[model samples]
Target: MNLLFSNDKRGDYPQSWYAASADLLAPFAPLGGVQRADVCVVGGGYTGLSAALHLAEAGLDVVLLEAHRVGFGASGRNGGQLGSGQRLDQLKLEKMLGAEDARRMWEFGEEAKALVRGLVERHGIDCHLRDGVGWAGSSAGSVAELHDYAAHMDARYGYGLEVLDREAFAALCRSPDFQGGVLDMGAAHLHPLRLALGLAEACVRAGVRIYERSHVHHIQHGSKVVVQTDAGRVEADHLILGCNGYLGGLDRKVAARVMPINNFIVATEPLGDRAAEVLTRDVALCDDRFVVNYWKLSDDKRLLFGGGESYGYRFPSDIRAVVRKPLAQIYPHLADVKLEYAWGGTLAITMKRLPHLARVAPNVLSASGYSGHGVGNAVQAGKLMAEAVRGQASGFDAFAALPTPAFPGGAGLRTPLLALAMSWFALRDKLGL
Candidate 1:
C-alpha cells in the first residue's frame, strides 16, 4: 500500500488555531536538477533543519530536501510541550543502560532544552516560549507514582520538582479531574511551527540549500552518497536520514526498526476568561496514562488538546470526534466548546521504547523512533548527527549504542502486530491495570 500518498492527501493541516495565528512566510522552491553538497538531509523538519544549520555554519555545503514544506511533519503539528528526558523514564534508562550512561543521556536532554532556548533568543524567534510543564495524575495510584517519581528525581538526580497534593493540584490546574501532579520548571511549551519555521529561515541564512517538494526516490551509497529525487539529485560525502515516521521506503532496514504510529490533536475556539477557569497556570498539561492527554493554552487563549492514536497509517475520519471524549474526560466543563480544528501526525516508536539511532550503512546515519518525545531529543539528534559527520562522534555513538529491537514481524505483518499490541495497551489503560 502506498501509505505515504494516501496519508499525505488526507493529512491537510486542519484549520489549526496555531496556523490561523502564525505569521505568513514565503515558500521554498522545489528541487529541479542535479546538485551537490557536503551533506544531504532528508526530511526538512526540526532534525533536518537543525542538522543543516549546524553543518552549514561549520562551512560544509548542505542540501536539505523536504517532500512537502518545512515543519509540515510532526515538527509543526506537535502539542508543543518541550519536556525533559526521553519518552522512557530516567530510572528505566538507568536500569537498561547503566547509571553513568543514563546520566549522560539526562544531561543531553537538559542541553537540548537549553539549545532550544538559545536558538530562540539568538534568532529572535517569537514562538511564545514558556517555562514549566505539569504532569498531572489521572488516578490515585498514578498520583502516588508521580509523587514517588518526584522524590526519586530530587534524591537521585538532584532535580527539583514542585509536588502538589489533590487540593493544591486542583488549585493549580483549576480542574477537578486531577488528583495531584508535579511541575517541572525545566520543561516548557512553545509554538512549534513558528520555531520550526524560524529554524528553516536560520538554516537559509547560514547558507544551507533547502528544497521543498523534493521527494528522494533512491539513495546510492558509496564513498560518497548520491541521493536521487524525481526532479534533482545530490551527491554528498555524508547523508543524514531524519525523516522519522514519514520515512516511507527510503531504507528498508532502517524502516523496519521503527513503527509509525498516528496521533491526533484538536483546537477549541478561544475560551477567553473560561480558559483561565480551567487552567490557572499557563504551564503545559500532560496526564499519567498509557494513552496520555496532553494540552496547553495557546497564546491566543485557544486550548490545544492532543490525544488519540492509531498504529496503522490510516487516520480517524472525524479527529474531533475521536478526541472529544478524552478531552471531556479530563475537563468536562469544556464539553460544549466548539472545536475549531483537528489534525494528525505520525511518530515513530521502537519495541524497547527508545530512540533508534544508528548507521544503517557506511556513511549513512539515521535517527528516529523518538516515540512522542521528539521536541527536544530530535534537535539534539540533529546536532549529534552533525557532530558525527564532523568526526567528533562520542555523543552520537552513545545513542547508537542503545539496543533497539525491530518489530517481530517483518514489514508486511509489522503493522498488524503493532496494532494488536497498542490495542492491548489501550485496553489495559481502560481497565486501569
Candidate 2:
C-alpha cells in the first residue's frame, strides 16, 4: 500500500472541486537519467514549491519532484482556512516554551500568514483570497474559554480579535449549535489548489525545475545528498523532505514523530441566494472540536464543508455522507442538498500538534506535521528552510526548538493506538465534554 498509488492513479490529481475549478498547468515531465542541483526538494506541495521558489530566486539551482501533480495531495483538498497563530494555542505555547519564546513563535505565525499574502499579491494568484475566520464554540464552557483566549491574545500579543456572543455569532453564522466565537480579521480563506498552482508557476518562472510523477523512493545521505526516484536520480548540495503525510518510509525519524491521517470534504451544489443563510459574510467558520467541522462558501456559491477523520491510510468508501453528518449539524437546511464533489486527503500530525522541523542530517532538512494549520505554516517552513541553506538559520532554529515526540506505540501499533485515542476524543466531542 504505497500512499502515492494506493488510492489514486499516476499523474492524476484527485477528483476534487479544487481540481475542477483550478487552472492547472500542463504536466511537467518526470525526472529521467540523472540530474544535479544546489537543492533537491521532494514533494510538490506548498512547502516544497515555496522552498524551490525561494532557493531559485536566490540564484541557486533547484529541482522539485512530485509523485503526482503539484497540489495533488492535501494542499488542494483541505478546508482552505488560513488560521491565526500556530497549530497549538498561544497560551499552551506560553506554558510549554515560556513567554519570551512563545512571543517569538507568535511573531513567526504572523510572518507565516504575511508570507502567504505577499506571495499571492506578488504573483497575482487569483485564489479568491478572502478575509475573516470565525472560531466558533459549541458548548457554553468552550464559548467562555474562547472569549478568555481572545482577551489574552489581545493583552499579551496585541492580536485584537473580535469576540462574538451567541446571538452575534448566530446572526453571522446562522448556526443554532454555536454558542459563541471569535472573529479574527487577520485570518482568511482561499481556493487552496489555485494558490498551490500559482506557487508552482512562480517556481517555474524563478528557474526551478519541476518534475511530476517523479516518485522519490530513497535518499542517500552524506556530504551531498542523492535522492533516488524510480526513473531518475537527483544529487544536490541540500535535500529538503516536504512530503508531509505522503512521506512513508523515506525517513524513519520523521515517520516516527509524524503520523499520517485521512480527512474528507464535500462541496454542495451551488446554493445561489441561500449561501447567505450559512454565512452572512464571506468569512469561513471552524468549530473547536477534536474532529473539527470547517466550511466556507465558494465563489460560485457552493458550500465547501470539511469534516470526518480516519486514523488509517485508506479513505472511507463514502466520503461525502461521512462529511454530511457533521455538515448538516451546522447547516440543517442543507441536509437534503446535492453534493457536487467529494474528496479525501492525508496530512501529517505530531504529538504536540506543532510542526516538526529538523536538520535530519548536516545538509538535509525536513518540515511537516502542520496539524491542519499547513496553509501558512508550510509556506513559512519552506522559506525558513531556504534561509537556513543560505547560512541564516535563526528562523529554522525557532521551530527546531519545539518538542515533537514519537508515537508511543511505534510504527506497527501506533495507528491502532491513535485510532483508539481519537475515537475517545471524538466521543467526548459528541457528548459535549
Candidate 3:
C-alpha cells in the first residue's frame, strides 16, 4: 500500500500531542491547475519549507506541495532532539572519509545546529527551544564510552561538552538506571511541530505558494522538470524532493537507497510537581541502546517518551502499549503512568546512516535518510539544496560526498531483513552487549 494513504487521512495531521498543542495555520488550498515556478518543492516538512523559504527570500518564484498539512509527517512527530552530529558520529567519519573531510563534516554539523537556532530567533518561532541534551548510559561501560567520546570531541574538535559522573548524572536525570553520561549544552530540544509550522509561516511571508493536500504522483524530468499531482501540475526550472519516508515510488533511485521505517512516541499525563522525579533539570535524555530510547519534559510538565519495538509495515494497534514497554524500562516507577497522547511516524534511513543527498538529475535534487537526526540535518539539507540551486554547491557537496548504498534485498525483502536485524539488536540491548 502507498504509505501516504496507508495509515493516515489524506489531508489531516496525525492525532499527536504536537497537533493538539500547536496553533496550526489554516489549510492552504490544494493545487488545481497548471502552475510554473522557478523551484518546485514536494513535501512540506522541514526540508521543503526551509528550501522554499530560502529560495523565496532570494526572490525566486517557489511552489510547495504537501499531501497532508505541512509538518504532518515525522517533522512534526519526532523525539524533538536537536542532536550534535550526523547519524554516524565524527570518529566514524574520520575513519570513513579521513580527518580533513571529517572535520568538514563536523563543521557542517555545527552549521546545521546554528541554522536551526538562527531561524528560530530570526523568525520568532516560539518552539520552546532550550539547551542541554543528556546522553545517559545504563551500564558503567556504556558510561565510560560516553565520557571518552565527550573528551575526544573536546580535544579534537573543541566541542567542549560537560562530562557528568554517576552521582552528577543522577542529579540531572533522577533515573536510578543511569550510571553516568555526557551533557551537551550545545545540543537542544523543542516542540518539533511548532518549529515546522514556524518555518511554513516564514515561507508564506516570503511569497511562496503553498498548496496543501496536493499529492504528487509522477514527474517528467528534463531541462525543465514537470511535477504532476492529481489535480494540477508544476513545471519548474528546478525540483526539490523532501518527501523523506513518504516518497514511496515517486523516484526508484531514492526508494532503493533510502529505506522507510516507523517509530512511536507517547506523552504522559501532566506530572505536576512530580516532574522532578523524572528529570531534575530541563534537559532531554537519550540512552545508548541500539534501538535508542529518548525523552524530555514538556512545558506542561508531561513526560514525553519515545521508544518501542514494532517492526511491521503498519504501526502497531496500540502505540502507547508498544512504547510503554521501553518507557517502563527507563522509568519503572511510572510503569502505569497515564499516557495522554501517543503517535507513530515514519522516517527514512540509509545503509550508512548518513543522509542521502544527490542530484538524481542535473536539475532534480533529493535529500532523505536522515536516520533520526533530521531536526538539524533536514533544515541544513534544505538550505544546502537552496544554495545549490543558486550555483553555490559546496555545502551540499559535503553531504553528497558520503556514501549511501542501496538496500541489499531491494524493496520487497529489505523490510523483513531489517525486522530480523532489529530483533537481534533489541536482544543485544536487553543483555547489555
Question: Against the true structure, what is each candidate's TM-score?
Answer: 0.97, 0.99, 0.99
Query: Native-vs-model 1 lDDT?
Result: 0.86
Counting clashing residue pairs in each candidate, in order, gives: 0, 0, 0
Q: How close is candidate 3 to the true structure, as a TM-score?
A: 0.99
Evaluated against the true structure, the overall lDDT of model 2 is 0.93
In model 3, the Cα lDDT at residue 289 comes to: 93
lDDT of each: 0.86, 0.93, 0.92
Model 1 TM-score is 0.97
Task: Give the higher-lDDT candidate: 1 or 3.
Answer: 3
Residue pairs whose backbone atoms clash in candidate 1 = none
Which lDDT tens digits does candidate 1 get at residues 67-171? 877887888888998889878878899999899988888888889899999989999999999998999996898899889989999998999989999998999
Model 3 poorest 10 in a row by lDDT: 308-317
lDDT for each residue of candidate 3 in 319-405, tens digit (9 for 90 to 100): 988999888878888976899899999988999999999999999999999999999999999999999999999989878989998
User: Would you list the rank order by TM-score, best first?
Assistant: 2, 3, 1
